[model samples]
Target: MYPTHSLLEKIKLYSIILWPILVTQISYHAMNVIDTMMSGRAGTTDLAGVAVGSSLWAPILTGFNGILMAVTPIIGHLLGKGEKQEISRSVLQALYLSVVLAVVVYVAGVLFLPSILSLMQLEAEVAYIAKHYLIGLSIGLVPLFASNVLRFFFDAQGYTRITMVILLITLPISAFLNYLLIFGSFGFPRLGGIGAGYATGLTYWIIFGLSLLMTKRIPSIRAYRLFSHWIRPSLSAWKAQLALGLPMGLSIFFEASIFSFVTLLVSRMFTTDIIAAHQAALNFSSLLFMIPLSMSMALTIVVAYEMGAGRVKDAKQYSWMGIALSMLIITIASVFLYFLREPVAYLYTDHPDVVALAMSFFLFAIFYQLSDAAQATLQGVLRGYKDATVPFVIALISYWGIGIPSGYWLATQTNLGPFGFWIGIIIGLTSAAIGFWIRLYYINRRFSSLRS
Candidate 1:
């Protein structure tokens, strides 16, 4: 039987794994914030272009990456069950899946993005920048997906700090590249907002190379033989991963797409300044989101590890611990947002009206912070139990079924205008929180019965 831990021991274990994951997560989200901030400094059109491009890119990337998130639990399960030999095979299959998915995403983005952007009625320069920015960013899809798989593989084995170190090393390089490419400094071409995309792409390559090196160089990880053997592509392995991953992917897609759709809707209804402001508020909120997001990720690792070891009680306790920690942290962040909303808004742009409007959006963002944290952490808990399909259905119903339509009706038909969408976001997230809580309760009972 697996050994159990006291609450304090669990807390210590969780924090050790969590802090690095948190930093890595914060660093990743900060790259997007950096892109928005630097692009804004370039000019209004550039900022709008990057914002629009990011809107189109975010959901797709998040959804696709969500599919790869399966690697964590799969590998964690193997490790927990003392099946170390199987880890390499799982990683290989995940790598194969990543390549296929990346290619599909790239080809689709290349072929269909222009047509979609055209329908948006964007300004000429904004359209041009947005289109090419996506093209540049798309170039990195292969490496980005590949590196993420490796990251999950490492994190699953409790090597969260390895990925964290890799990200920290690359984060500043991404910023410098953005500076040089965006402003045409140091003899680089002045691609403006488009450069941000290219810089991001190049950074992906660097990150991938470093990740491969880590797999080989790290003594403990090297034992897994991730690189030493070539495993042929296997259809059965692919199906096994997709069985668990697809619903997880779709659930994430539904949630992320709602925000992207909201941005698109706002673009159709408002001016470039308004879109930029909306993006600014969205970007900063996304940054704060990384805190809970990281907690959720850690929860997935911890919970899955416990479950794989047949320690259901420990997994349950850890899940609650993660949720409580997330709530406490988000409460502090919301207060910070409330007191410094204007300054935070101004960080994105100098335009007085945009800053004022963004500050207003921040208030709505603050309202949803608690719900967002609760739902995100709860989803992470559910993922630990390998319960994804129902969350996908719930996300579909709450986000598209309830959230978007209500937001649209309020935005166009009522007095709330753009603000109505934010209200919709709050409503949707609150619904998700409640839904996930109920689901978790039932799942816990089911697991408990099985244990008895």
Candidate 2:
């Protein structure tokens, strides 16, 4: 049986493990909220422009983020095993690979933005604004990918606080930049929605620079990269990274694309007001999700380290501890969101219809957080074990087979509308959580028995 601790001890441990993650997640989303608010002030068209453009932009960026996610577990295992040289080499390779990937995606977005926007069937004004925003946002892809590579490297080293600090500074800077650029303040010309894009692009470079500076200070990282041996990429090492990364990357793409597809479907059925409201609720939920996300990340490092150290039992304990903490944090956040629903909605928009629609979606958001926390934590645990492919399959089935169909049925066939759509999300999340947890349990048991 797992060991139990005092409630106070549990809370303290959870705080130590989770607070940095919570802060990073909140700060990241706070930047988005600030962007939405600033652009909303520009005009309704500006708000819709950002929303639609982001729908396309975020998935592509997140796909690259998936590649970096593959780096963390490998680095964590290397760190756990005291293979410092290997860790350094992995970091360098990840950075090089990420830059290449970013270039490919950025060029694709820039070259295809006009055509992509046209395919979305958006109004001419909305499409024009979205295309302009994409052009500017595309410039930051390399920096964003660089930042993520650094984040995974540091996280594997158990220095998550570094990311929290970087985000704290970056967010305020981004917000300030947005204010000046979007409004033509500080003698800056008002570029409107495109200005918001520029602020976001600049912030990515700032984050990348700060992360690189911090990495340079670490003796291990410095030694590994400065040595001539580290400059060459191992074909085997690259293959290993790709083997571990591609499935996980595809899994992320699958999940994100499902949401993107749903957003498009909803746009087909509703007005811009409804789409904006859906975006607000989705953004808020995604922010809240960072709490669990951060914990899951922490758990992945802890579990991977423990496993690498040949402490299988300890690894299992860490997984349970992380999951318990994630669920509790999400539950508390859900209650807060429930009571403050109206105020939360107001933060995004003042339109009565949008506000009402956002509130309705919040109802589903509250419930979904529990399942999301569970699944994400388990997924993190799985990453620690190098069990990526199975989880990918489970996610595909849950999101596509169950979640999407249920959502369409309820939203269009029934009278639930946007609320119906979120109901599908809730179902998908629950299925994923249960399936992932079961998989983790069995895998751990088998590994433990094999070791014995």
Candidate 3:
């Protein structure tokens, strides 16, 4: 095909896209670490309040972002076919969708925050703090989604560096804001956990504004005249995006909420130390997990672009190359986690019980390495083909239908204690990986046969 890159060239191209994403994830993880450390230092109640509040809020934001994510591949495929004009139109439709989605999400999430908090049966002060925090965060959802629209446009134009730089630039400022507001430092009121929310919301709005300016001025974006014209919602285009977005959004919600559900439902039965240990293991694994996730995102970009350009064979090659690279990297990384579980556990907390509890899960965590990588990368492969419904269903079945009940059964019904819950995660991830890999194989075969 006219747009085909050689295998070696594909490798280089993949690296270019992957590294920024990797760096961006790493940097964002750093921000999370800082958030945790600072919040922990403030007080346990503050930390707990933030955690509870975040659990309720994060999935909603993630689900909404999933809807927005459809635009990335849409723009990618368009760019691949040299359809610059179409890119402008597609992105505008994305913008319209974001506006409507943002309004709906913000209104619903904020309006229902109190009732949800009450359902959690949290302490009065904790509930109050969490409610206010959720409100603060909700205030910024529209701007956040809008920035995401700009982000997709940039990514499709092959300039992820803008996003990476913007995020990296925001980290220090965000950290500083949190610090000042959290502890009443620099003469700020000590709003505690609520401060974290306000700081985050304000930062998001600021970033959103900056993104708008950047979108207007960036050479690549300016050419699209993305902001120069008004774009109303086209039912057909919105429907296409929704078709992909709803399943993807639900899939993300399913996967992310499972862990939250485990923490909320299963953790109550365990000690605080056990919960902390599980969290520590989760943090370490999540940081390490970013590599595969980045590779997946890169794979989606490459595959979508190649497929749209009618380089079906190249699309297949990209998919497999990405899967191979992810599995290989994760395998090596998992070995380190298994062997150095102690030190890794120690880095998070000095509590012996927490460390012991954390150590117990390293084996299972190691087991998750290949399965998690496979599932995540396969999801990306499917995303390139705009195939989300199947993966979403697979994740639903694996995580909820299988993993949740299994973990609960083992944790409560069996003698496995809290460790049983983690075992379920392993099972679920493995099942999903198997399903996704199978589906991806068929998707690849179909794409590879696309010669006219």
Question: Cα deviation in Å at residue 85, candidate 1?
Answer: 0.9
lDDT of 2: 0.79
* Model 2 error, position 134 (Å): 2.0
Q: Which residues of candidate 2, in runs, are more than 4 Å off? A: 1-17, 218-230
Query: Tens-digit lDDT track for model 2 on 100-219?
Result: 888888777768777767778887877777777777777788888878988888777667788899999899899999998889998998977778888888898999888887767777
Q: Order of all candidates by TM-score, from best down to worst?
A: 1, 2, 3
**How big is the positional error of residue 261 in model 3, measured in Å on the Cα after superposition?**
1.1
Ranking by lDDT: 1, 2, 3
Where is model 1 more than 4 Å wrong at Cα? 1-4
User: How much does each candidate deviate from the true structure in C-alpha RMSD?
Assistant: 1.2, 2.9, 2.4
Residue 143 in model 3: lDDT: 81
Clash pairs, candidate 3, are none
Q: What's the count of clashing pairs in each model shown?
A: 0, 0, 0
Prediction 1 TM-score vs. true: 0.98
Task: Give the higher-TM-score candidate: 1 or 3.
Answer: 1
User: How do all models score by TM-score?
Assistant: 0.98, 0.93, 0.92
lDDT on C-alpha atoms for all candidate structures:
0.91, 0.79, 0.78
Highest TM-score among the candidates is held by which one? 1
**Superposed Cα deviation of residue 246, candidate 1 (Å):** 0.7
Residue 280, model 3, lDDT: 62
Q: What is candidate 3's lDDT per residue for 83-117, written digit by digit as tens?
A: 87788888888888898998897778757767777
